[model samples]
Target: MNPARALIVDLPGPDLTLEEGRFLARHSFGGVCLFARNITTPERTARLVRDLRDALGHDALVATDQEGGAVLRRLDVPHPPTPMGLGALRDPEAAREAGAVAARGLLDLGINWNFAPSLDVNVNPGNPVIGERSFGSDPALVAELGVAWALGSEAAGVMSAVKHFPGHGDTQVDSHLDLPTVNKSREALEACEWLPFRAAVRAGVGSVMTAHILYPALDGERPATLSPAVLTGLLRGEWGYDGVVVTDAMDMRAIADRYPGGVGAPLTLTAGADAVLVCGHGELTPHAEHLNAVERALRDGTLAEDRLQEALTRLASAARRFPGTPRPYTAAERERDGAQVRAWARASVTRVGQVPRLSPDAEVLLLTPDQPGVGGPYGDSLGGDELAATLRAYFPRLRHANYSPTDARAARALLDEFPGAPALLATPTRWNLTPVQKELAGLLPARGGIHLALWNPEHARALPLPALVSYGFRPAHLAAVAQALITGEAPGVLPLAAPEVV
Candidate 1:
């Protein structure tokens, strides 16, 4: 295998380095997975993508993680409610629109492949990586929403890779950190976690990304990324997933921690993965090593010729299928799409109890998470910025106090200053509150306004207050929550299942 054509690596910055440019030329590794560092502005991004395509040809697989709401490489793009948030809406139109909007934005930046519509059913609240990233806990809901999102994205001229195949939702441990074992039988897998993948396959998803987690029921020792039983037997043999099978970042600890020095290359390819995402994190050394390992195995007869040919054929087929192109939305289309997203946000923000009615001049205290510059669910850049500005716009006399949820004393002090004054408190997460935050929530006064749970709706049930779930952290999401609180017209049901606390 040619290292240049075989590897999908990352550049050091927005502009390609001399080595990167030379390496990414035709017959080389032109497949570049973008990250935050590679993005600057729309013009710069389009230019960069154009340059790469010019060098690598139109079929070059240029990608980025533009999964709406948080996991984004380009902040300039319009991000709709996260998959979990869309799950709360459970509207196929909304889900499809969200995907289309995100894909259109990415395509404007000349990114043809979006690793999005994460199909993992979010069953484990403690799952660190795939919580809000996933659609939701329910299998049917996830399947419906995920497939809709994928189709919409594909229609927008961007290849939507429904990811973390066979599900990465139930595991508590993050595969990015270490190996997470999902101790479920094949029957159990078929019933819950695997449903979305099944739906995606049936719907003719162009690509399926393998998860890093180990399922003992499928294979004894190997994770899904390196297991033939999971990738070849189940995905290819049984389900007939003829599309490309990409491994989820071989540099991730789930693969890297076990097979040091690019050992996973031979294992992953032989296990039936069509593409190995090893070079995206900006380390070319390991990528070179992986290529060398693959070449050595091929020459030594350790890795069979049939497996290599299968992977190459799949990659070629994918290139023919997805000729990377920019699909810009018209100005009117952009505005209409934006309106649709805002409408969906309004529709998805759910109210659980009494939504406090504070006057425009009422001295209402607003307690929000102090997320500083953090992105994703923490901040849509949500914390203390968009949320404060939106709520403040509604309630001019709003007394906003930002608090670190992890630091109880700091938040407690903020509460002390408020002194039982009716306050709008928002706690954002896809899981339960931090013990400290939970304690703080309990200590709040009875009429502590409304508990606005952005991503973690269940936490509102635990707080000693009525709750409203925005199910998102985008500015529009915050605006929707404020609208609901102001007008008392919120209409959304929490997507997750469980009894509400008294």
Candidate 2:
């Protein structure tokens, strides 16, 4: 039987060391999942994947979380910003095209598998982890767009893994912090949460990743990751999902905190997961310990060897179906991809509120959140530089500022610079609105109109502003917003459940 082993390795940056690559190969890991930290340039990333395949042989799965929008892992390389931006287009055709573009980009980077096209329906607008990463609020729309993306990605020769099965969209708490429980009945879950995943499976998605959330309707005491009723019974039996079922990061608080005897990986596989992604272990020591534990379980007959072979066979079959090829993009192909990125970037713009026409020569102020210079728990490089570059291209006379505590001081400074300039708050969603920003939103009617560009809408919802606009944090959105404000054009209308706020 194939070895009961899988690996989760972090790329230092842009490429992997020969030693690191060889280590993974010698260990015979099932796969490696890439994060933003592993990417730098397209060429370098492609070379890294090539080296990994060469070292690990053709059977290894090279995967990335290239879901687009908020969950996008590669930004140093050229690609559109987020998934919500594409969802805002509300056109399945557009979503398909974007998926094709993303697939081509991933293949160019030497990645054969994508942990993307998040099937989680964004039911809770305030969900901390899934905000702009989700397609939209409606389950039907999310399923349509997500299925289109899966089909497009597969067509482009990359296997797609639909994620957070049993839904991670409705919870307010992030599973990264602790286990989140979904108290909805099976009927309610089937109607709202399970629809998108069911649609994805019907579309022939290659894989499904289990969520860490607990569903009382499925299993009262265990999270979905450890619940056979949820994974094997519900997903595999009831829904007829025969594809490989993988667990989300096993190191997440939900699994690590609750697992008995720390046998999370063994328990996960026993519960019907084909693979366990143990991310954020930091060093090889912890990873080696966990892998050893799993191996021991197999030896002791605690983890059935048949289950391990089944998982390895599915993983190998998938690798063969989507075989590795070094299709390094040429200059012409790169240029074409660049153009598509720009177009999708434009399509993602969502104008949540009306903005009155401003004079062509009117000065505009741009304010962005003060992201840490070095990335910490949330990952580094929050796209602040990219936002600034996009803004400068659109607004030639734009003035900019990083977020600060002294809102009165900052606002006064901007007022001093351009006495009549209109202010536009262009920021990634933060935990809460600054008092200055909040006061400014309230004062917009008395002064001039304030336009808010939400990189993440969950952050935007924190402030109750009437004239708020949302851009899924794509460069094209910035350009489109700037043009719409300069000219007398109505931005694309937000789909409203309630009456229009006019």
Over 4 Å off, model 1:
1-4, 372-381, 405-420, 429-432, 499-502
Top candidate by TM-score: 1
What is the lDDT of every predicted structure here? Answer: 0.77, 0.70
TM-score of 2: 0.90
lDDT by residue for model 2 (1-502), tens: 6443444444445567776766676777777777777777776777778777777777778888777654566765456446666666678887786677677778877788888878787777557677666777788988998888887888888888887899998998788878998999989999989999999888879988889998999899889988889988888888887787878877778787776333787777878888778665345444555677788888899889887877777777888888857566567876877777766655555555445666656577766656623221235434555666676676777777665644456655765677667766655653445676676556444446555555556544445443444445444455666666666453343432232246
The C-alpha RMSD in Å for every predicted model, in order, reads 2.6, 3.0
Q: Give the top-scoring candidate (lDDT).
A: 1
Superposition-based RMSD of candidate 1 using all C-alpha atoms, in angstroms:
2.6
* Backbone clashes under 3 angstroms, per model: 3, 5
Model 1: lDDT to the true structure: 0.77
Each model's TM-score, in the order given? 0.93, 0.90
In candidate 1, which residue pairs clash? 4-28, 4-29, 379-382
